[model samples]
Target chain A: MDNYNYASFPLDMDDAVFGAFRTQAPAAGDPAPDGPVTDLATGQRAPLSALWRSGPAVIEFGSYT
Target chain B: MEDLAARLGPRGFAFAFLYVREAHPGELAGHHATFAGKCDLARRLRDRWQIARPILVDDLDGPLHAAYGMLPNMTYIVGQGGRVLYRAMWTDAASIEWACDYLQREAQERRTSKRVAPFYSELRGFRAHDQYARIFMNGLLEGGGRRAADEFVAATEATEGRAAADRLRAARQELPEARP
Candidate 1:
């Protein structure tokens, strides 16, 4: 995906970009990727596992827009 | 999501919102040029929305978001072992709550009932959601300002709006004529 800067925000004609680039979601029981995430308050990078180490977690992903 | 967090938080369920690239970038919120800029937008989003759950911002390229499927407003349930328990293309609070409740009950059954053995299974294709125009428009406005919202409206008008209206008209035509 190209950099979605302000100028390039509406570059895609429709949702074609998503259709082409959307990744298949991890199925149930699959190991969730433990990628690094940035904490909003502290700006410190931490492992994604930190969120669910104690128990299960419901994580919602989206942008401000 | 806040309500879900509150309802299920005590039940050993955690919640967080992962901030990603703007879904509809425009002038106001625009695209995140830098990680710092993305964080700033995320902070503003938190303050503006008064989100209670912990906000975790993704990296600029969104490796995690892409890995988990790039659909906007997607949700996932990660268990203690970092295993995906549930995932949905769209975030529906009712569906999420149902999944959590079901999982918790299964856990309880495993602990208390020796007869029932837990096994992995996938339940899918149960889709119900509310898509109100006002809410969508609000998000567009927040992200890209008037231009984004306007463009979205125009696009919808060109595609879904006309197609849906045409389909509705055709369906009506198939119905028996009303008595005078």
Candidate 2:
């Protein structure tokens, strides 16, 4: 799914759709992909690598909606 | 999450909440149009949810989110050197705490015996679904506005959706805290 296109709310997240999204994702033992992220504390942009640089990171991806 | 951070942070685990695409976009919580807008929404989320963990806001269009599977509330425990240790479909604090503990034990074992190495495995992680679904929907509606409830009712049937709203209206503890 394109990141921009939300495909609307209450999506038909059936077993197949969930499987496609889950199976294609990065899995255990794979190198975590690094990208840009804005650290909320300083309100400054930073690389995703920064969060993990200090130690093992537990990242929970989400949003308000 | 705060308690987990307090207990495990000292043990060298850094916890974060990565802000991503809005799951249910509506008037109040629309699609991320700009980076600043997304950050503001993220800040509001952190404040409203009372999440103490550092909130990392993903860029608009969310390339990072797409690459990581784009699940709404997925949890990932990434170990040192950027190796993924555990990836669960949903964030379950208890299960995550157990994983952290397991990782700690694994590191100790590795110190004693050099045979320990990262390996691939999967499991069906569970979440407190029934009531939490209601809670999650309430959040979506809060941010997304009235249309959120309307679409939800249309999709899940007005009876089912109204039942949830009624329960929420007659609520006691909406956000249940789990303490160790």
Candidate 3:
């Protein structure tokens, strides 16, 4: 079987340009990226950084199905 | 994660779920080929799981998921200044609890010292919850039977390798029969 690159084909992480996997996440002291995300319930767009402005945030990424 | 969020959320810790692409797509709720379809699935997910925290959905193509290692379940703890304090490949309650404790203590110390803390990384063991595991296996069986299981196993094996797929199969075998 071929090496299935989920990061590229089905879902492009823009790894070649952004190097997302190099660090896996923002550094301890570095600022987190304010990426665009839509509120699932409300269908509104907002930067993720805005959510954690008040304090620390615990983010869990997953799906139901 | 929800339980921890409830416990720490009162203490100024924001907990949110980022809804990404489907892990085990089947005939019932298969993969989303469009953004609207993905959003609909997200709604169904929120209803099914009774997810209380704010849920942010990624784009249909999954830019966020890919940026976050494309894992089915990944947890990240971001501290003050929006810095990533911890990242777990798989969601482990014990490790997250430890992280919460560490962050709370650090926040307290920062009140007086105003010092920055270093990053902490550890290889914590993964503990699968029995009930949820059963639900997942049963869901696979109900969704499409052996074919669903096979597709799930294949997907897991592709991303996490054969060991993880084997573990899933073992768990599925232990599931009790469904009532008529």
TM-score of 1: 0.81
Positional deviation of residue B13's Cα in model 2 after best superposition, in angstroms? 0.3
DockQ for the candidates, in order: 0.57, 0.62, 0.38
On lDDT, the leading prediction is: 2
Candidate 1 or 3, higher TM-score? Answer: 1
**For candidate 1, lDDT tens digit of each residue in B31-120?**
777899999889988988789898998888888887887766889999988889988777878889989999888778778865675466
- Using all chains and alpha carbons, the TM-scores for the candidates as numbered come to 0.81, 0.83, 0.77
Predicted candidate 3 versus true structure: per-residue lDDT over B1-180, tens digit per residue: 778788988988889999887766655666667788878878887787788999998877777676666676778877667777777767877888887898888778878888884754556466777676567778776643555566766766766678987888777877764322
lDDT of 3: 0.71
Winner on DockQ between 1 and 2 is 2
- Model 1: which residue pairs collide? none
Evaluation by DockQ, superior candidate among 2 and 3:
2
Of the true contacts between chains A and B, what fraction does model 2 have?
A: 0.80
Error of 2 at A24 (Å): 0.5
Which candidate order results from sorting by DockQ in descending order?
2, 1, 3
Candidate numbers sorted by TM-score from highest down: 2, 1, 3
